[model samples]
Target: MSTTDTSNSPITNRRRGTLQLWSRTLIPTLREAPAEASTPSHRLMLRAGCIRQVGAGVYDFLPLGMRVLQKVSQIVREEMDAAGASEMLMPAIVPIELYAGTKRDVDYGDLLFKLTDRHGRDAALGPTHEETVTEMAKGSVTSYKQLPLNVYQIQTKFRDEFRPRAGLLRGREFLMKDAYSFHTTVEGDGGLNETYDRMYQAYVNVFTRCGLDFTVVEAEAGPIGGSASHEFMVNAETGEDTILVCPETGYAANVEKCEIGDRDWSFDTDATTDLTKKHTPGMPGIDLVAEHLGVKPEGMLKTIVFAKIGGDKRKYVLATVRGDHDVNEGKVRDVVGFPIALADEKEAKEAGFAIGYVSPRMAATRDDTLLVIDPDATGGVWATGSDEKDHHVTGFIWARDLGADLPTKDQQGGKIRVADVRNAGEGDPSPRLPGAKLVARRGIEVGHIFKLGTKYAQAFDFTVLNEQQKKTTVIMGCYGIGVSRTIAASIEQRHDEWGIIWPVPIAPYHVVITVMDPKNDEQSKLADKLATELVEAGADVLIDDRNERPGVKFKDADLIGLPVRLTIGDKALAENCVEFKLRSEDGKGRLVDIADAVKETLSKLA
Candidate 1:
């Protein structure tokens, strides 16, 4: 079947047999979610008996959960195959040497699960396979003719999460579909971008078919360093990640990577004021200092001292921003081209800087220090540190007080650097369209695609001979969908107060036949016949054939949240019909003729 096929046709049915509830399996429905359940997805997953906790951040999928997971995986496989990607398997327990090639062992930090083998060799569970796949391509593929290959696997990955909460949303062990592409050159039609585009469309198809309401936003590559990347986020109010969106321009990005439009840094007033220092003892924070000076926070300049990490020389960096704004460390790292930490009191003191009373004027004196000034603080007259303990400077204008030599770019000695080092706030101008402002929303990241460039291939020495007979490194791209987390995210997006209202595509069963009383021969026969017909007509039918009370069966049916519910009761049978209800809708369903039940159910499924 084609990947784009949307109909619930028989050709797409993977499981042919019918499921009988109360006899064949277990669904331990609960009245209340466990106290630890924080999000809607976590609560619904447990109360519906879809999953059970094995440990902190570990979970065991029950039969119903397994079925849904399999269905989701099948959809992913179909879309990936349709995108011309080959499926393969890799060992989850990867050797530490693979990561050593990329130095990800240190980069991943405590999140990597490491172990010592019996042979005294180091091993670690794979959080991702960029290194492994790059190494494999390095050893196996060696010619341009064998380039432009994409390989993927649906497998479980492990990360030693410190706080794994929200059930499957942030589990230590979870299933993921990760695909890596290799190419000879990044230039033409048959290059990394071509495959990246195809994978992007494939992700769209998978999420659309799975009936998720999601947004594709530009994202930072985090630990998976890459040139360009995007995240597929399922929109929800309770989601952890913040996304900035511009509805007017249809531009969206994760907050970490979001860029804001230029701000009007021109002086609000041309009035000049001389820099004056005054003693204010023991003012601990910006709010307190602002109050001490009888000024608003926005009228103050915040100076922070940072020390460069992972460098041979210990260098102190000064970062300045508007007092109301917080410095985005990621942006600072991008500017400094190295990791940085807040300089300790002793380090700042030794560097000839006051720990809390440093000012932009110090940049003029300390030419060796790297100074990063936020755009908002460029030309404003503001209150700031006075380079003396227990003292602050008021009416400090950048042009007048900080000297004429200011760095417009990075790493220019003896000059103050100007850049956007502050976090983009809610009302900031949008980066894309003129006059548009950015709005913030919450989202759960279910999928991500990265344009990896040659970071991995270079590290692993993955190269191929080109048509010109010269050696060229392979450009790579990595795409991943959190298969299990997608399930939780869907629930987070789609569930109601009662239970999970599963989308038709990934729900364990499409139609649930509730026989009011199994002992009633007529009702029993009718339900069995309907199940068989529904199964043949490309619907997963679950028969609630338990010898339970009518109220019990109906409640369980509602809690299970099958798309369509067929209740075979004595009253409905006397009327020569059965009731058909859609779980998403309210009220009792209208009666349909017994002979027409199959056709009506099929119509609803369509």
Candidate 2:
């Protein structure tokens, strides 16, 4: 693509003159701001003139913003290519039947934006392209030699977020590039691991080049069924989710799995403490109960109920954590290993799972119900449940009162496995760093590469003939780049009070030639000469050919955030010199001969 052709869409380029090419050009900004926009990224995106509000959750990308979007897409393409991933386009629209076979289509519920086509067939704007890519891979490639096939596409994806906030970080209508890889057997594991690592590194490189400060931390595999997954977060103080890190150790995780600090607390064995039921009025929360009883919160067993798969009834579990600690439902969900969500009051009542009085003893009754308890809850003289509303039993011991049903070393029936299911928090010990603690930060996810093994291939019956003439379905993996979202993320992670700091690699025009006095004869000639030299020096050059004032031109240039600025004025015209400035540095300026400016810019870029 030629520089100008690639710069803007045909429609936008024509309007650049009339519309005035800047965020100030009809920017959709709010005065008081909406309460829904929770993060700086979300608010700034609107003020920066990058995106427009199409609806409550949807957005439309504008001209200058689209340039940054395309640049992010190019970087992703380069990295995926380096990782041996080939590129192809897939349809944004998908049929419902393909999703029905996999069951996720229905299971996804409201998240999938479902609609009917002109033909009256059910369809979904693809949230991801696992089904579509595998369907393509299955029809084309055959034999074990073609065992590992990878394909990707950068396209717009639609997801109906229950609450879409954080600007481009989360949106209803957004851009995402999803890639899928097909493998035949376990032998493909090496390449899979290799490419996964490569993609991870590539993600780092892409984010770094875009001038974003972020963290690649451990994350849970939600919805996507896999053993390993990583989350790239931008460190911002206003982040909604709490992340715990061990500052001492450098271990990091989302707060759900963030491990609490370990301490020694001995259970009282000698005292003949009575376990009596007592009314605890108006204390619905554990913290409230702990304060009322003059005991630590950890000294009590907290029960929570969850609605499970294939039933209207809810299952209740006694979640015992020290009052100082918190619950990790992700760990509980892993144990449940079924479709389960936090149970409501109605579901709990019908299932005989009490809302206020729930106990660990009820979990093991062979009554066709499930109970998974937190590990720290066991082997303690703690306050527990009476199974009656408004009453609890203190001085209750686990092994003495309800023995053998508690979880053991093995993850088996009626046994609560000791695992971290709570949200990982910053300052918590890093699981990988041993004794060290992790510091937390926020980040916008610009790209994602998933090793989608057989999730799609098995669904589509995507099979190929092997060398042995036997037929087998190809295993697959998928990767993606949110081309448009990256621009917003880059800005979120790397912006100033003024505007974005566009990097040299992606900035639309590397050098903006500001004709300080466009009408001045010498200044105009000097500006034209400088522009020609810069263009010849392999820099994408933009001349402020508009008859605007020097201050106005400078303001627009700064707002645009180009890396290099070349100013031509009366003082430079006489000496055949031009003023050059680097966008990153403080208002420092250098006078260079008109000829040397080109050489200097080319050298710096080189």
Pick the TM-score winner. Answer: 1
Candidate 2: stretches off by over 4 Å: 1-39, 42-45, 188-191, 221-227, 238-300, 306-318, 323-325, 333-345, 364-372, 375-386, 391-419, 545-550, 571-576
Question: For residues 1-606, what per-residue lDDT tens digits would candidate 2 score against the true structure?
Answer: 235653366564232211122223443333434566656556655555556667866877765566667777888888778777788887878998878878879788899999998889999999987777666766777667875666777788899999886677778888876766667653435345556676778778777776666666566663445535666665655544455556655555565545555422333255457787778877878878777777877688776666565666434444445445666777777666766677777867776766777776666663556666555565657786677777778888866666565544543454444444455455555665556656666545555556666567777777777767888767555556676666666655555655556777777667877877667777767766666666644566667766766776666666666788888877875787888898776684788898788788767665
lDDT of each: 0.86, 0.66
Report the Cα lDDT for residue 351, model 2: 69
Candidate 1 lDDT, tens digit per residue, 448-512?
Answer: 99988888988987778889999898899999999999999988888777678899999988988
In candidate 1, which residue ranges exceed 4 Å CA deviation?
1-18, 221-227, 267-295, 307-316, 333-349, 378-381, 387-395, 403-414
Candidate 1: the clashing residue pairs are: none
TM-score for each predicted model, relative to the true structure = 0.90, 0.81
Q: lDDT for model 1, on a 0 to 1 scale?
A: 0.86
Candidate 1 worst ten-residue window by lDDT: 407-416
Candidate 1: Cα lDDT at 298: 93
